[model samples]
Target: MFLQNNEIRDLLNQVADLLEIRDDNPFRVRAYREAARVIEQMTEPVASLVKANKDLSQYRGIGRDLAAKIREIVETGGLEQLRRLRQELPVSLLDLMQVPSLGPKKTAQLYKHLGVASLEDLERAARRGQIADLSGFGEKSQQHIIESLGRVKKSGEKRLLWSDAAVHARALEEYLMDIEGVRRVRVAGSFRRGEETVGDLDVLVTCGRDREKDVMEAFVSFEGVKNILSHGKTKSSVILRPGLQVDLRIVAQVSYGAALHYFTGSRAHNIAVRKLAQDKGYKINEYGVYQGEKRVAGKTEKEVYASVGLTYIPPELRENMGEIQAAADNRLPALLKRSDIRGDLHCHTRRTDGHGSLEEMAHGAIAMGYQYLAVTEHSQKVAMAGGLNEKQVLQYMKKIDAINEKFSGFRLLKGMEVDILADGRLDLADSVLAQLDLVVCSVHYQQRMDEKKQTERIIRAMDNPYCHILGHPTARLINTRDPMEIDLEKIILAAKDRGVILELNAQPDRLDLPSSYCKMAAESGVRIAVSTDAHSVENLELMENGIAAARRGWLTRNDVVNTRSLSELLRLLRRP
Candidate 1:
């Protein structure tokens, strides 16, 4: 089996943990760790090289000894040394290293001194105060460890949602752009492509040399800056909020666009272009491309694209997702626009788990230039979140009516995020569903079913007339969880046939109908509803990711639900 990058990284970490316990070659351990980091940054699947019997040594940091062993494992499915290590120490011991506060050395110490093998056992020992009594485990550390363990239960997924990242990025940009001497700034990397969790935040800025120093100083002094990792005239790295690394690079005003294009990329996009340039007898580097001693493209990104014989690819389309192919064919998809969105159909208020009030949410949508807004509060099944029962739903609708009466210019549509129960039934009764202006059916539980069952369950839910849109279908949290087991092709087709809209959930963390799936849905003639699924006024802005992801799938304004005017949207909703 081809190992995923995560699997390889996990194994390397396990090796490091084993090395720490044995006090083996420190350099060997360091090599494995470095190799893991390098592999993590590699865009191409490394396991394919292993499977193909390609030289693993070709990758940087993978020296001969390690490369041979990697190939051996690929050929035999196990490393002799790793197996021996597992025999001496239970492989389950590796789980201790995954705790938030614990690293390899700490895990080794725990295994050696406290006999802790897993987070569960560690938590049990800590709660009983046994951990506090151990050598090196002080009371404060023990308390902190216990709290970290408690946090494990609350860990829904490992990564942040992509929509959330964009929201944070925009907020950061707005904050930075207004600062003195700070010129243009753009968020780069997977976050730009709308990936849920980003490893780091890459911001590119261009300013004259006179203002560069102060801009750098201001960034490092920003409120969210916890620590400055590096600071220079042109580039700086800082640990921002929640310990996320924010790397800001400054470029000359002339090269601002080129630098933004280079920095704001999925590594795959950069690599593909670099290789293309190489094949064309040009050297493409961070500064610019050169043909021998001559500078061919350096002033702007547009020139760089022009040098490569293609139109400038938008940062959003820099995923190597047919951009090169389209460039080769001299064709680029007409990306979706903000104007294509007519209204947001799923929003929440303080009546549920939302931060804003109903009136505030509606007005926020209006401020976004939306023609209509749907207040989709949680259903009664999610009682913990102040979900609405049938009576509460009716009351909320009445409140919406009163709000609509008072608020003009934008229409307020009453809706409910009806929970898709474990057995595939919507939380609300048919009567309650029928009473709503629109129903967003979503799987709120039992997301771990087998593929066949999940597909059948979702298809059954799609059959419900009140189910106008399937919310966050597959229930993926971007980089964290795998998209749930539903057969997406079947789900898309069924939704299309039933006149059900597949939601392009803009919650960044759950851009559930991904660009790839959205493209497929579009090709299948399935209508898409791009929704923010916003729980707060600020979150209403997440519709941008929805628009971007849809564009990646080649969706235009007309292909998206909200792109329609209120009358057009209502006409489509009125069908079947």
Candidate 2:
């Protein structure tokens, strides 16, 4: 039984969430949560280490107690303590956390004070006027809860981040390839199309006909499968531990390409392609493309495209969004690739809320082959991050300059994620801003400003000569909060007019500058800075997510600023 790191991490997080719900020791809960984060970030499999008898305690956050808990989970697929805690706390209480703005602390208060055990219970309490009377949750809080319940129900079928799904998909790929007769395995569907959130994973496989039953059996036994939905000789499906449902289909190698094309679809894209095939006197399906009762093209995806007289479309562009026409016109974009990114422009250091020191982040950038790294710490407007004042910013700039002298072929660009004050003025003065390599201004607070005010506020910041880019432009958190009401199109126009770049934040929850808006920016001739907004060394790896998001937006090398060499990038940031 092999468990992926994310699988282990998710189970650990469950324990943490449970502990916090019951008002357990804060340090104890943090330990489990930290251990989970360490495991999730690990490239190596925790299950493999346990099998090898390696001491998991060697990992930074995993202590003796945490290591023992991990061992129990690895050996038995669950932590005994988590099961026991669920019994005492009414596991359904955890479900209450799904409501927007309703956190564990609030949930605990609700449960303790009102016997609220589920979403239904909470709704009843709020509707009965009991919640508004409670401490902390006044009329507005009760109203917000009432408003958010519908969203919770509508979004009940939880989705996994594409990155998380990829981890499981890769594990499944290795597992299937190890089978005696498996020929090829590829996870299709939105995963291939690189949607930010995936409803489920669809894996297509090709294998020896004689081994079809064996493949199906092995798939069901996949280590992370939480429940087996079905089992058959040629097809099977299972729900993984983290609530991601995966389906497996064994096909002959002859139809692999056709099956893959059909599976890796936006539905609308597939429909568009079928229309093309029909017009070409061909019928395309999962089996093969038929030419009036004769098989014509099916061996490869490129062949599938050629049969219809079109170039092969990359999966990221298969959104039925002018891609087919673009392919016919030979206008498909040369989309951005991971290798195109040369530096991370929006990194934070220990000077603020980040866990990494200047030297540590510089080394991490070096490890990732980055030519430069912009240490963009928050300004004083964000008091929670211990945002830096002018004095602190000046001190950090000197540190960056000193640090740069020590490393050849690497530079630490002094930058700040300055706040765009509610009235549209920058938080920092030009005296300090002029001393930095770049300035990334963002709206960290007052996110709920009316659309007109929000739009004007960001546009006003773009007018600042020192502002090089806008960070997480829309301020939306995936599955948690909706995007700010700022007119992204207006912002894009302003960025183009003022030479400000827009950021594609790579954080899993905040893949802001959603691909659609990114497309808007690119088409307007505004460059994007695909920064990880990394707080720690490990967070820099999130550039992969940003690159994926960038490609989805039809961005290319020339469309991104950081893709340039250090000299070229510095030249670009030079303001008029």
Candidate 3:
């Protein structure tokens, strides 16, 4: 009955979205949104805090009332205020906001003007030319919406970020393991593969064959189960409350590894492995590796791979992208591990849009066992974030200097996430940028520029000696907006030439530098900083997501710049 962190965040976000749709107090709505953000970044479960009778109000953005509401959710498994809000207004209206580039304002417009309560309704209106006539949405905007709708519809199946899906999958695995009859439970499928997004989860459980029904019953009765899709003696499927599908299978321990390998597949990888098995006069399947009906090897994934004369491939590398050949050749990379990261290069504090104070962020970094952290707040170009101007930047640097004095071992490096202006110049002047320890230049606007121009713009920014890293290189938001057409090859090469680092931003929604591109950068010998770009103390925990991405991209400890000692990293950041 424990609520996963993601569930709490989703519920809180629902409240925020409902409040926004209802046009409630802006501050109140912001509080909820901020609270959701904080909860999502938390490494520890809020439910655990609730169970311990901890003071939740101490967390940023959670006041006394929000604390009580959170407590009620943990105890009752639902929020009464959210229930009342949904009763006042149908929740479907918020789905339209999922369309790329459509904000709450536009969503409300569609709802108010065209009675568009769902994606279907909105599409019908747009195709009928009704949306074009709305006050704010003209023909051009309508065309854009229509195009975006196609993107939304084409996306199909509504996948959640791997990290988000992990929250549910891991929770369910643990919950199932607690069942008396359950001998073992492992979350398979894309979650195990470390795919950036997961559409569904396949959970394999090994329990007494005679107790299958008992396990099936418990699976369907999970607290997060929103709907039972099926119930059976050996297998059952349920859709979790957050719309993630989970399929539970009762497996025999003897075939557990084979089942895990079969279920945790990139279909092509499994097919290739099966082909290899066939060449060896054997069959590989979920049941077990068979040689003319007699089981051969399948007790472990390593056995399965070895039976085919191949070494075991890490789950992250099983994308059928030459991994089989690499495994056979014993050339697979020793992937990056979480422990290799020494510090985060991109960070923010109260000086910008971040929720944490400077000292708070530093302490959090220290708690993470980091040797250093870059306090890279936004520059003046990002006005909405309370971006710092030149004078403030000077004061901010001075503040960082003073803060650094208090810490004996850990260091707070002064820096800015300087906006890469549309024409390629940095938001901060060279003089101001020169005074900082590092600069992470990023594009906050003009994301629609043609591929060539975007590539040129980013390369030009790298030409600036102070620009040490390119933050979120593609400026992509997963499932929301497409990556800008920057030629990553060109950017990677430019970064190498300019001694600039590329960032693998660990934000769940923006795991920028997708694994494919991360591989490209690695092959080109460009170093990466797997920074979380943390905005809160909790956000620092997101570094794991970046590590996961790095592993999937075939990066090693040497491929990441942050794995170096503080002195080495400082030397690397110092561009020639």
Candidate 4:
């Protein structure tokens, strides 16, 4: 198993806690804590160095004794001191430490006296009139734990984006790679697509017999592990670092493809595949697909799909989005590649409320290989948000011209996130809007308007020659707010006739226009613009989410506006 600085650090945190509770050596505890800090930031995977028998003593803050212990942890599943501490203190006592608000000291105090184990039991004891009687855990401390548990429960089901998952997955990969005889390992599912919210984590690994048990032990003992959700020979789940649940599954070399296919999913897609397998007189599971007489699909995913007379689906398109039909019919749309995007049309900067300066924003876009960037700051109506008033808008335009002047490559278009007022009028003056390179009209206020009013506002905005794109048309945040009611058909038709593009806002929280509407937008001859209504440098990465959402609508690159080059975009903008 390979251990990363973070994984080692996490393990040290647990060890440090156990030592403190056992009243063990203070310097030893400090050593573990310091070691963890050094390991957490170590760029290279630790297991590789261990396999090569490299000198770990060179690692900063790693002394002779600590390096030996790290070697012991890498080789054996457990350390002698850590095992002794565990024997002295119940493993269940770690549950108290798992609560968000409880620190190691508070956890030790609770365990030393009250004999609390799990959070549920602690809550019961606290509420049943026993906590106040304890020495350090007065009403305030008790209340804090209860509140923390409640908050944890409420926020539990939320998913993490792929970007966040990579951090955790890389840590686990490093820890597991250190184990002997383990081969390739990779992360699959929504994390691969870079989706913002991840439901469960799936890691695929290949290993030999001796390594499996050792790997499982090390995996279960991972510093981030809060609870052993479940463990088995082929698979195991552990709640690591808060409510984030990670599930790891191991496979023999042959079954790797089958296992990955089974895990990477939209449940609907899997079910469809299973039905196909049934028709072909075979059974498919995480292990391998079997015919009544023999095993067929265990070695590779392509083989698994080929058994069903279909092409293997790409991970991004494994959402049952007519993939099965396309596979059977051999008509799957070639999904858009990252390189298809020519420019980023809707972005924010410090000239408005964005975190980075205009130059920084453009440089970031350029760094992402964008040929052009539309610097669309907020219009004057949103005054509270440092919106660009008339003078500020002109001054910013001049600044943008200066920026374009200094920069040799890539065009920066002057634009604004103009508001669609309650009266179905754009907030910016027509003459003022005409002076800009592009305009994106969106709804900021009046989200509560009736469907007729909202539809009319959107339609009226689309009719304007200056309005290049209708940003996040319905103003809905997935799983949070209901899409504002609108006559989408009528509005889409208007946009089509007016040659206006409807934006699929790439912000994770607001993948607006919904996938269904985007399909309709595409059919209406109204091009769709997948733009990251980015407020910061980091926000530009939200384009993946936009692409994912667009995929759900069966969008092709040609149907998207931003896929057009600057000349093409200008040509479309010049349409009557």
Candidate 5:
């Protein structure tokens, strides 16, 4: 199998985690972790680069040694080093480390002292009060472990994040398009709907009748296929490495649109549309819309919608959430697009945990045609990210001024992603915050407060006059960490009242301010800032994902604060 960059990145990260568990040299572990990050953020596939004989060492964290390792994985589809590491470590330790609060050290301790080798064993130990007797794990830790085990058990089949899924989807699409007689190919289902996570891929294709068998054969024989679940002349299902299932279906050209519609569905949306078709005395199926056995509309999605007395609806809005009514009323929003974004409000630099320098980041924004960019580095509260102290922030402001002076048309706004302390205090003083162009307040710690306290903490933070935006409002990492306990409605109402722009953080894992909440905030007259929260120059591209999320929420260009020009955005921000 041709290894995708993500697969290699995952293998490298697993190697690093295992190394940490084995108490290897910290720098060696960091080397693997950094290489993984470099691969993860690369816009180009490492395999292609390797095929072209490009110098991988030019990448941020990849040195000559790491470059060789990457090539080995790309060419061979496996890393002998990682395989050996796996052989040495208990494989279950990896799963155990995924539990919240269970770091590599703790995992190692559990393995060494208590012989806790797997989640099941750990659960048993915790239930029997054996975990509490361990060297570092007390009764409270045991309870926390038990709670986390329940969460892990509940989080069933892993779903790929949209960004991760896009890589695989595009690769498969390209792979299938190369077949001789394939007419059209589309990836349907929640992925097509731009959902945050997708359970599997539904690939729909149109091909000549004679080519159907050939297409199915080619699909199941693809390089990435791990196992064939089922095979047929027109339909085939296969499981890829890492356990993502893909189902491929071949349809006639005439039934392509109908099949696409049927496959690209939220069950509710499909049911509603089918009922509408039935009410109009037409039978709709994956093949076509039939009027008493005579084919009517099926060749195109537009015709399918036209048959139902409605204009075509974009796939992102196909959640059956009043979209049909909105379509009938001609009230479907002109959703925000990537080109509509004029600036980025939340980004980081090397002064914090970010990899890029201020100049590199500014150049990246300029390349994207952004009129302005905000350098919102972490505040002192997040010291692990090398957050700046008061003096450091002032000095950084001087540096930004220098850079701003260097550029004629572009502007760099001095901003800080300040921490909202547990007691509802800003990490930086008002005097310090008042000096900046903007402040993006967020909760970095104390995420487990009771609902009232968490809500109140956020509300108080929003109430601060200098707080212009709320960064990653819920602090949820998709499929991993659950959103903190808080009344989001109360927080949204407070943001509306305070004129605090809610952020749709564009980082793939932290696509916070989910589509549904974005809709609520939009309806409440709260504007959203779809900022990348970018840590590197490459990460600025994540804005597209943010725009996708906004479109899914039915937000228009006017609903996004950064879609406005500099002066207009500043005016919005300055409103007290």
Candidate 6:
């Protein structure tokens, strides 16, 4: 019955969604939403606080009422208010909100106007040309809905982002590790490979044969399990309530490594490895490596790889993408680690839409051992985020200087996340931009431009002498928004020529300059910056996601700009 942070956060988010659909007080809805964000970003589990009878109101956005509700949820595993809201509203209504471009207000409109209560209902209305007649939804919006529905249907089972999958994976791992006789547990497959999205979780455990029943029983009876698909002595499958399928298999210690390798495969990688094993007169399978019916290697992944005549390949690089050859040649680049990062180049504060103030953000960065942190507030073009104008930015510069004067060792880089307008002009004046430590330019609007124009627009923005980095190059929000159409190869080449760093935005949703592009940039000799475009101090932790993406791209520490010391980084940022 233990509730993890994600579970508690999800419950709060559900409450917020229901409140929004009910058209309840905006403040109340926002309170729930804010509380959800706070809990989601918190490093500690709220359940522990409840267990200690500590007041949750000490945290931001959690008031007395919300704190009491959190305590209630932690104690009882349910909220009466959320239960009542569920009763009042059809659960399918919440599903509609998942459709791209369908907010609660628009969903309410569709419901009232066309009786659209589900994705199916909305799809029918869009196809029948009924949604366009609604107040806010136009013909284009209707078409978008239809197209989005098609994507949803095509995507099959919903996939969770790595960040989300990690939560469930860790929770299940913890649960299984606590069971008796469990010797070893590992979450394999794409989750272990560090893929951005995961469709299902594959858990492998090594334990005594007698403990198989106990393990299977415990797994199927997990607190978050919504349905048990199958149960057997050695294998079991269950669907967690969050719509993620988890398959657990109990294996013998002797075959644990082989099973791990087999389950952690990108099919292509496994096939190549098997072919290599066959060439050496050895057979590789889930059970073990066999040479003339004798088990030669299996107890360790390194043993399996050695039997195949290659060094052990890290899971992240086991994609059969030249990794075998690289391993054979002993030319694999050292992958970047979380410890390699020295600073974050792009972050926000209360100066813009960020939740925390400059001081709070700076101290948070200091805690992370960052020698420098950039204050990259949005430019004036992004009005929705309360972006700053030239005059305002100048005033903010003075404040940054004052803050910098307070510390001798730590440096707060003066920077702005300037917008690259439709015509590719920088949002802030060059005079204003030149005065800062660095500039992070991005496209905030007009993302639907054609490939040529979009590529040219970005390239032109990079042409600016003051532009240091391109923020969220694709401007994608995973599962919600598609990346802008652009000639990425041309942009990468342009970035290489212009000395502009491509940002691997660490905002879980927008891990832009994605692995593929990051690889391209690195191969072309363009150093990338893995930055957390964090709005809150808590969000600074997202740097881990950026580093994961970088590793997936096969980037070395030398390929990242922020991995350098402050002086080295400053030299790199300086224009020729």
Number of the top TM-score candidate? 5
Comparison by lDDT, 3 against 6, better one? 6
Clashes of each: 7, 0, 0, 15, 0, 0
- How high is the CA lDDT of each candidate model? 0.77, 0.89, 0.88, 0.77, 0.90, 0.90
How much is the lDDT of residue 465 in candidate 2? 96
> lDDT by residue for model 3 over 199-259, one digit each (tens)?
9999999998777888898899998898999998888999998789999998888998899
Estimate the TM-score of every prediction: 0.68, 0.92, 0.93, 0.70, 0.94, 0.93
**lDDT, candidate 5, 1-576, per-residue tens:** 578878998899888989999999999999999899888888887899999999999977899999999999998888898889889988889888657778788888888888999999899889999889988778878998899888788867677889888888998999999999888999999999999988899999988888888898899898888999999988899998868899999888898888999999988998899899999999989999999999999899888888998888999999899999988788889988888999999999878988899999999999999999999999999987889999999999999999898998899999999999998889998999999999999999988777899999999998899999999998988765668888989999998888899999998888889999999999999999999999899999999899889999999998999998888988999847
Task: Return whichever of 1 and 6 wins on TM-score.
Answer: 6
Candidate 3 clash pair list: none
TM-score of 3: 0.93
Runs in model 5 deviating more than 4 A are 97-103, 129-151
- Worst lDDT run of 10 residues, candidate 6, spans 97-106
Of the candidates numbered 2 and 4, which has the greater lDDT value?
Answer: 2
Off by over 4 Å in 3: 51-53, 84-90, 129-141, 181-183, 208-214
The residue pairs that clash in candidate 5, if any, are none
lDDT of 2 by residue, 528-561 (tens): 9999998778889999889889989999999999
lDDT of 1 by residue, 445-556 (tens): 7776779998998989888888899999979764434567678988988988899998988865577788788888987998888899886666787787778778667787
lDDT of 6 by residue, 428-466 (tens): 999999999999999989887778999999999999999
